[model samples]
Target: NAGVTQTPKFRVLKTGQSMTLLCAQDMNHEYMYWYRQDPGMGLRLIHYSVGEGTTAKGEVPDGYNVSRLKKQNFLLGLESAAPSQTSVYFCASTEAGRAKNIQYFGAGTRLSVL
Candidate 1:
């Protein structure tokens, strides 16, 4: 089973273009998250979903929107992309309320906005 999966592993966009990143997990996790890594910023959470249909904004959610329609899938959207928003986006998941369960990460999607 794929622990976590992200589509479109790499993308390039002109400023103001729109795109969506897709994430999926096969581990039946209840918690899913989206994070972006950039120079000096380390990693910052952009959005999360605690369960199917429940979503919330995270530390750097300003330019992103997320939806979780099924337990195994989470979608992140950039309505209007910008150069500053370019980064390596990662998706992670783990069983909810189990502190001992470590999150599993997908191979990140590298996005470049010009």
Candidate 2:
């Protein structure tokens, strides 16, 4: 109810299975982001959208796809699950002109692929 929230707080998937992770914000922010955190690797941006109906690839977009069909929602989809894709995923959002570093984040989604 404060800023952002991600659905399916935890998930487990088998190799080759497909799933979608959803991020929803109540702040009505124009910029939204998706990131993955790995052991000792820090967080890496997977994808982002500047505004509704617009999306861009980030540093680690190879195994992921994203969409922002509505201003309040962003979706990340994995076509085929893999062990390498397992990580803690976070969703963030902020005002268009606000400092990118100052973002509101979801509680995070834990995913494991076996």
Candidate 3:
């Protein structure tokens, strides 16, 4: 089973252009998250869902939105992309509220905004 997969492995967007990144997992995990990794700031959470049909804002939710409509999928949408948003995006999943569980990440999507 594919643990997690991200669409459009690489993308280049002009300022203000919008795009959606799709993530899918087959692990039947209950917690899914979207995070952005910059050069040095480490991974910052953008949005997360505890379960299917539930979504919540995260540490760096600005300029991004997320949705979890199916148990195995999470989608991130950038309505107005900016240069500052040019970073690697990773989608991760873990067992819900299982304190002993660690997150498993996707290969990541590289986005560049000019």
Candidate 4:
């Protein structure tokens, strides 16, 4: 994907509630990924897709799922919300054949679980 965009800039969910974060990219990219940033730790991968219609688990896949039915869109879904899941979520995409593998990131979605 080229330019990434994420919806729902901020959200607050009660325990057990669920929501889906939408990520869209303008250009067609082979690889797309989702990450979450906490206070101290660096970004942690939540899920990723190699191509359209293919998704793989990432470093922090628990409690989350991803879908890439279209080449320019990726969706991150939370089956249920928890306090530990509250964080700033980011979506990124990069061209697979590029040497630099430079990724374009979305503004981010801030989720707060109470």
Candidate 5:
């Protein structure tokens, strides 16, 4: 079963272009999250969904939006990409309400906004 997969392993965008990154998981997890990893800082949460049809803003949700219409899929959209948005995007999922359980992450999507 594919644990987690992200579309477009790499992407380059202009300062104003927009794009949507797709994430999918087969684990039927009830919690899905989107995070960005910068040079030295740890992963910062962008958005998360507790379950299908439910979404919430995360630590760094500005300039981004998310949707979780399907139980296995979570999508992150950048309405206006900026150079500062250039970072490694990781999608993660975990079992519901199991804080002890570690999140399973996708390889990552490297985005560069020029």
Candidate 6:
């Protein structure tokens, strides 16, 4: 099974353009997360879900939204993309409880905004 998958590995957007990034996992994980990686900084969480149909805001949630409609899928949306939002987006998942400490990440999606 595909451990974790991210769609549209690369994208270029103009200011104010909106886009949705998709994340899917076949591991049946109980936790899912969205993170952004920028130059010279550790990955920052954008949004996360504890389980299907449940979501929460993360450290950098502004200008972004997330939904987990199914146990294997998580979606991140940017309503008005900005240059500041351009970064490598990563999706990760892990098992519940004790196993949660270990997360598997998808190949990041690179986004550039002009």
CA lDDT of each candidate?
0.95, 0.94, 0.96, 0.94, 0.96, 0.95
Q: Candidate 6 regions off by >4 Å?
A: none
> What lDDT score goes with residue 109 in model 3?
99
- Higher-scoring candidate on TM-score, 1 or 6: 1
* Predicted structure 4, TM vs. truth: 0.95
Model 5 poorest ten-residue lDDT run: 94-103
Give the alpha carbon lDDT tens digit for every residue of 35-102 in model 4: 99998999999999989999999999999989999999999999889899999999999998749878
Clashes of each: 0, 0, 0, 1, 0, 0
Candidate 3, residue 47: Cα displacement in angstroms equals 0.5
Better of 2 and 6 by TM-score: 6
Residues 16-69, candidate 5: write the lDDT tens digits.
999999999999899999999999999999999999999999999999999999
lDDT of 3 by residue, 1-114 (tens): 689999979999999999999999999999999999998899999999999999999999999989899999999999999999999999999997749998999999999999
Q: Which stretches of candidate 1 lie over 4 Å from their true place?
A: none
Model 5 TM-score, 2 decimals: 0.96
What are the TM-scores, per candidate, against the unseen true structure?
0.97, 0.95, 0.96, 0.95, 0.96, 0.96
Instruction: List model 6 lDDT by residue over 28-55, tens digit each.
Output: 8999999999999989999999999999
Candidate 3: clashing pairs of residues: none
Candidate 2, residues 1-114, lDDT tens digits: the string is 568989989999999999999999998899999999999999999999999999999999988999999999999999999999999999999889736457889999999999
Please provide, for model 1 over 74-112, each residue's C-alpha lDDT reduced to its tens digit, 9 standing for 90 to 100. 999999999998899999999999489998999999999
Position 113, candidate 6: lDDT: 93
Model 2's TM-score against the true structure: 0.95
lDDT: the better of candidates 1 and 4: 1
Candidate 4 colliding pairs, count: 1
